[model samples]
Target: MTEQPRLTTREAAQRLGVKPETVYAYVSRGQLSSERAPGGRGSTFDAREVDALAGRGSRREPGTGGASGASGELSFRTGITLIDKDRYYFRGVDAVELATAYGFEDVAEWVWTGEPAHGSRFTAPQQFLDAARLAVDALPVHSSSMDRLRVAAVATAAADPLRFDLDPSAVLACGRMLIPTLVGALPTVGQHRSGEGRLARQLWQRLTSQLPDEASIRLLDTALALLIDHDLAASTLAARIAASARAHPYAVVSAGLGVLEGPLHGAASGLAHRTLAEVLERGGAAPVVADHLRSGRRVPGLGHRLYPGEDPRATALFALLGAIPQAADALAAARDVVDTTARHTALHANVDLALAVMSVAFGMPAEAGETVFAVARTAGWLAHALEEYAERPLRMRPSGHYTGPRPPRPLPA
Candidate 1:
């Protein structure tokens, strides 16, 4: 049997001369049809339908104009989070302020249920903890923290018979348990703390060999809250797509983790870490910035597509770091890099830069920022999954526009 030709979203976007999000908008409106590619990689559009849509030069409805890689403009509605030119909002509250005022567990409950939480606590079940530990220990000793997280998610699902429950309340409850378990499952280089605090405190214990003071732990919490959700990132879309199929909550998280492991997404912070490390080792920020430009490479941790002037998250994190006397040197290096990068180009330091700065300032491992992002983003993913579950299932399938020659003359049958 001959397989029908198809176009990926990126290819369809090019054919129609529209953004990728616009292509998704077309799918959402039923202007185009799509199906899951082999292995459920992503949706593929009918090539013929896409070509037809492209010929017509489709335009989305007004008032929906915003950048999104998955859903078109505002074609898909999400009450979870909003991103503007300067600030990110989670359910009408400023994310930076929210982070400062509350722990990430509170942020998780708020975004997932749309209500501020009072004294919420997250703890892993003993059985789930034992299972997660077995799973984590099964991985190679050199596996990244994210690798452990992925394994833990799958293990958690397998251990929970009720994981298939799709009710919002059940899903939210799973999140409350899953977040802490996921953090606990990681390989902690330091001495484990005996008492309990928040997720960030526990996570800090996992990532570093040193004990963190109250101020440092608070900064880590703020960072986690700030990273909780940001509209529909690639990983979020992956999570939603999985949820749209009614996959288990743990499976939804697995989908998100799969996408986040990509270099261009979650791993981008590690790149920024390397860049900043170079600046410190060279004893001058300007030289490294100039070299990156001369090589025509993007200065890692700098520039963002959505925010023109600055990343408010970056501003907030930097402010927190500035207030901590222990972070003075790390803060100064970050500023120098920012200054040099700005002088050479219009780019501004973004959240990735901030994450890298935080990790460096706190003496964490190279991928610690990525780990934080993955953990924090799980809250957003689960929220999006809930939203997708409420909508019609399998609505994310995208139709492709065929551009190839007519089917091989019927295979000369």
Candidate 2:
């Protein structure tokens, strides 16, 4: 095997399509590690490392190796969804069937509390509702749903009169109550002292106000089923860790939302919307894709990490999104591209790419795609949070190395 020749930082910058200053910044930031060439002259960097650093953008900078004889963990990127037959139960239930027949509230409870399919979210006690409302009101309206939940967590912790009710079952109920207020809708009519209202009913009643049409509720329901509970994803793991801490339902949910804000997990929906908008601005799908390919651009909806084949969720949602009248022309255009661009890979649409088209066709605000994803994915977070609470907590202490010289003692002093 041949060892590849190293490149100067200047050459690496040219390959990365970034400025020389950006390349230097990457080095200083420990993103693009450099080698001291034989003469100890100007730095040389690995070309592959520089290329990777350019794509990494603003994510958590990569960590160095583990301590003596210890290995760090690596997770495979299975985009959008996960099916864990050994541990999880997605295979047993028909998600599309439930999404179509039930309203969003039923699915919400199903994911969070693992209640029966037809079960109600109304079972949460009045005290939980009171805590949720107080938390919602305490939020700065400018905050996202994820942010509002953290505010709710502190309020929930402050208000929970019960000192000993720290188990998974109780905490999960709190999650169901919290979701409606944080993401989709909030109950407005509650008296500070009213008896327990239907959590599902109040949510649906409020949802109808923001999204009056039946179709929006249906769409919201489908979205939840599609996005909920992908197994053991990084964001899911973060949620689980928070849950393992016996964080109250509010804290656990907040933690999950925080994890979802990352691009690798959750921000792809918004990016897809951006991609779709640019394509539409260019007229139709074919020319837009052709131009993008010619310019070395990525087409958002056309690829996935998990399903090298067609994503089942993407096929399902496109059917729902395509039914709307405004989507007809664009949907037709997309299909035409799919047929003609078979050369682009027999790739079927992935969830985010389909969602980009749906966001525009459904008349959702550009940011609403992410907002909706946060809402849908919260159900999965709660489920993982509940799972976390059931397990004994791991303190997540990983070992490390000290590369510096050892024990110089008081000689320097």
Candidate 3:
């Protein structure tokens, strides 16, 4: 059969009177879908999709105006991260570049303070770690990693006498200590690494018992750094709201953790992990994808609403994963899933798929991705909270429009 013609990203952008980056933005927002070009160097768009979106005329960019709803227009000026076109940046530097070039501790410090501190390490104080571990150990044996994380946050907060201090420097210190504490509190799966080194090394011990090579450790570090921030995710918004209320840094993280429990958010990676495992077990992507569709479930680990094309983070991680020999089969399974689904939908792989590849390849649990997400994103939540603390307290309050009966009506009988 003759292959249908596809437009390159640049061609699609030109056709739509937008920049290539905007073309990617359209994919991220689900305004468009993208497929991999031959040789897999760039994305190609369905000519029809691009022309159809063009026919709709130029729409206002997201965050430019509020939609009609009970929640009025809300926007905030942030210097931390910007999601543009198909790539994202932290303080105007490419996030993928930053993540790949530095350790998770360095990248996270840069995200929070705008300067990368080389060789920086986060160490959880013994007292705080003790308190957090106690809390985590008290949970039911079956409690998820996220559950342990939440309890640890509260316990850590209680152990700090100055958690009420909202000073910028004080808050930053709290962040430095809190992140390591969260990681240290999780029950280890194999050998226990000392708590005095790189955050990723400590986290590796907790996730799996397999001895990791340099490449595997590098992959894990990059994943954490890449996930450190995304502009105004649901959990970030919640953390900002908590910061606006002058909540302490620990409380702010707790607030973000609360929102991460929803299946649509942090849990998405676990779903993707299960999906990739199924594809591997079933020996093909076709049946797995078919089973999901037949069950009326959208396939996980594909298509992100924010990038109409490839998710840049996924692109970067996948590139790194390709170098690890242990990752070959799982990575192939991920590609199979993407290729299989692409036959029907133009959706490309997202970070969850890459993360699932890591989890499945390393023999980690389904929920390992959630743990990585929550711990890595703690840095971002704190960064947003730092921004919010500088703004006027309570500035996030949006007035609600009354949608019920008139206020003048008497109380119900």
Strongest candidate by lDDT: 3
Query: Ranking by TM-score, best first?
Result: 1, 3, 2
Clashing pairs in 2: 301-353
TM-score of each: 0.84, 0.65, 0.82
Stretches > 4 Å off in candidate 2: 1-91, 112-115, 122-164, 184-212, 294-297, 333-342, 401-413
lDDT of 3 by residue, 100-203 (tens): 99999999889989976899988799999999999999999999999999999999999999999988899889988999999999988877556357888889
- Evaluate model 2: give its lDDT: 0.58
CA-only RMSD, every prediction: 7.9, 10.5, 12.6
For candidate 1, write residues 192-287 as lDDT tens digits: 666366888889988778788888888888899999899888899889889989998999999999999999999988988887788888887888
Q: Tell me the TM-score of model 2.
A: 0.65
Give the higher-TM-score candidate: 1 or 3. Answer: 1
> Lowest-lDDT window of 10 residues in candidate 3?
64-73
Q: Order the candidate numbers by lDDT, best to worst.
A: 3, 1, 2
Write down the lDDT that model 3 would get.
0.88
